[model samples]
Target: MPQKQIYALPNIVSPANPVIFNPDICNGCNTCVEVCQIDVFIPNPEKGKPPVILHPDECWYGGCCVNHCPLPGAISFNWPVQQRAYWKDKATGKVLRDSQ
Candidate 1:
């Protein structure tokens, strides 16, 4: 008989939160819930309540929620430290990149 080998994986903590919703600014409009491509936000159970982040790990950092939010400064995204820095050049339509 042959013996089977088991592998273990190391756990690493992420430094940034993919999406942050400010309850003070959030109007609970559900715009974020509708705009998220990954379905990260869900409507709160109570009416007129802020949506909840259901799947933070699944967020793609697409900024759809932030772009579509009706309230200013309601949503924000922070890239994980492990990922590279991303920026956009308005003059040439180029995406800028850098290390954290």
Candidate 2:
């Protein structure tokens, strides 16, 4: 019988939350916490305080929290570099990076 080797992916750590909250702009409504499907945000101890990101890695990047926010520019999400979309033109057959 031969032994099998198992390997883990290299150089990957738990990803940081792409979502950011502007404290000044946020009204502490907790809408983001309620909208997040992945349980990413948790309520702050103080009443009427903005929620905090409880599990950054659990976020699915669905944009629900950002869209539901009542205050404009309050919630911002920076998509991870690795998740950037690559678009290919069907007619030209050229590939373009989304961030470009």
Candidate 3:
């Protein structure tokens, strides 16, 4: 038996790219908080939101938040095509995906 590191490369450049936590859909579950290996998210005391990426560069561009998010479109990230940035959810964040 051996311990396997699923996320061996904490800093690996994932195609998932940088993603942001949307305040609207975020239920404050903190699932993303638990998953992130780089301590990317911090609980926002003032807003009572799930958490904030106080240090984004620490983010490995892994869309762990987006993939595990119970709410749709809560986390925004770049996909393979379009070269354009977009949020997976309906609500908008810092980026936008132009309708093609």
Candidate 4:
């Protein structure tokens, strides 16, 4: 008889999620999950709900998930405060990041 061995996944803590899903806008299409190159998301168990961020730290800051989303506001990308780059606009005198 072979003994069954079970292993649990580690709960890794990250500073923040690079990508976030808007529950109000996301239609649970799973498009972002399919488009992610780094496999950062896992399908949500509940129907019509946004997918779970299983591996937020694995995100490569790629906008594929956001760009491929059918709804404009379904997915959004965020840069960690440490990595967020800001520059002063000469014309407007407003500090803004690349995304802005």
TM-scores of all candidate predictions against the true structure: 0.63, 0.66, 0.53, 0.76
Q: Candidate 3, residues 1-100: lDDT per residue as tens digits?
A: 8997676556643433356567788877777777877877777675647576666656665777778777887766644454555655546445546544
Query: Worst 10-residue stretch by lDDT in candidate 3?
Result: 11-20
Best by TM-score: 4
Question: lDDT scores for all predictions?
Answer: 0.79, 0.82, 0.66, 0.83
Clashes of each: 0, 0, 1, 0
Between candidates 1 and 3, the lDDT winner: 1
Per-residue CA lDDT of model 2 for 1-100, tens digit only, reads: 7977968867544576567788788878888888888889898877776787778878889899999899988888877789888999999999988673
Candidate 1: C-alpha RMSD to true structure equals 10.5
A best-first ranking of the candidates according to their TM-score comes to: 4, 2, 1, 3
* Positional deviation of residue 75's Cα in model 4 after best superposition, in angstroms: 0.9
**Across residues 1-100, which tens digit of lDDT does each residue of candidate 1 receive?**
7977956856533443676778889878999899889898789987677787777778888899999888988877767766766899999999978643
Q: Alpha-carbon error at 97 in model 3, in Å?
A: 10
Compared with the true structure, the alpha-carbon lDDT of candidate 3 equals: 0.66
* lDDT (Cα, tens digit) per residue for candidate 4, span 1-100: 9988967957556745787678899989988889999888888998789988888877887888899898999888877778878889899899887764
lDDT of 1 at 5: 91
Q: After superposition, how far is residue 90 of candidate 4 from its true place, in Å?
A: 1.2
- In model 2, the clashing pairs are none
